[model samples]
Target: MFDEFRAKRVLSRCVDLRKEIYNLPSDLNKLRKTDPKKYNDIKIKLRDIV
Candidate 1:
């Protein structure tokens, strides 16, 4: 019973995280369109760090 409850809690948390990931705001695409230079800079920095 405890294991079933823990599994359900973990599954629920995963579902919540997936929903948050899918519903995230798409500002990067907008930035790419509006200010490409800044976007490229960000991309380059992310490339180096990530």
Candidate 2:
């Protein structure tokens, strides 16, 4: 029972992390045109998330 609860928690965290990472590329692309520094920062964050 404890294992099942832990598994669900881990899975939810993974899904949330995926969604967060998914937004990074689009944001990075937009920033690339206007702010290269911000784009690089986001890329680094995205890499850490993945």
Candidate 3:
């Protein structure tokens, strides 16, 4: 039972990672053009998340 729960949690996190990776580029670009500080923050977060 514990193993099953762990597997589901990991799978959900994998989906989250996929979404983050898909959206990251456009997000980074928008931030870069307007908010350099926020862009750097996002880059660090991406490195940690992905």
Candidate 4:
């Protein structure tokens, strides 16, 4: 029972992380074009998060 609960929690976290990464690229591109410095910062943080 505990294992099942832990598995569900991990799976939910994974899904949320996937969504964040999926949305990040477009935003990263926009930042890259408009502000290279901020873009790099975001890219690095996103990499660490993923």
**Most lDDT-accurate candidate:** 3
- lDDT of each residue in 1-50, candidate 3, tens digit only: 56998888878877887886687666667779999987787677668755
> Best TM-score goes to which candidate?
3
lDDT by residue (2-49, candidate 2, tens digit) is 699888887887897788667766555677999898778766766765
lDDT per residue (tens digit) for residues 1-50 in model 1: 56998888878766766675466447989978888997787666546433
**Which regions of candidate 4 fall more than 4 Å away from where they truly are?**
26-50
By TM-score: ranked, best first = 3, 4, 2, 1
Counting only residues 3 or more apart in sequence or on different chains, how many pairs clash (N, Cα, C under 3 Å) in candidate 4? Answer: 0
RMSD of each: 8.5, 4.2, 3.9, 4.4
Q: Candidate 4 versus the native: TM-score?
A: 0.48
TM-score of each: 0.46, 0.47, 0.50, 0.48
Q: Who is ahead in TM-score, 1 or 3?
A: 3
Positional deviation of residue 38's Cα in model 2 after best superposition, in angstroms? 8.6
lDDT by residue (1-50, candidate 4, tens digit) is: 56998888878877877886676666656778989987787667657656
RMSD from true fold, candidate 4? 4.4
As for lDDT, the candidate ahead, 2 or 4, is 2
> Which parts of model 2 are misplaced by more than 4 Å?
26-50
Model 3 lDDT on a 0 to 1 scale: 0.76
The residue-level lDDT of candidate 1 at 38 comes to 78
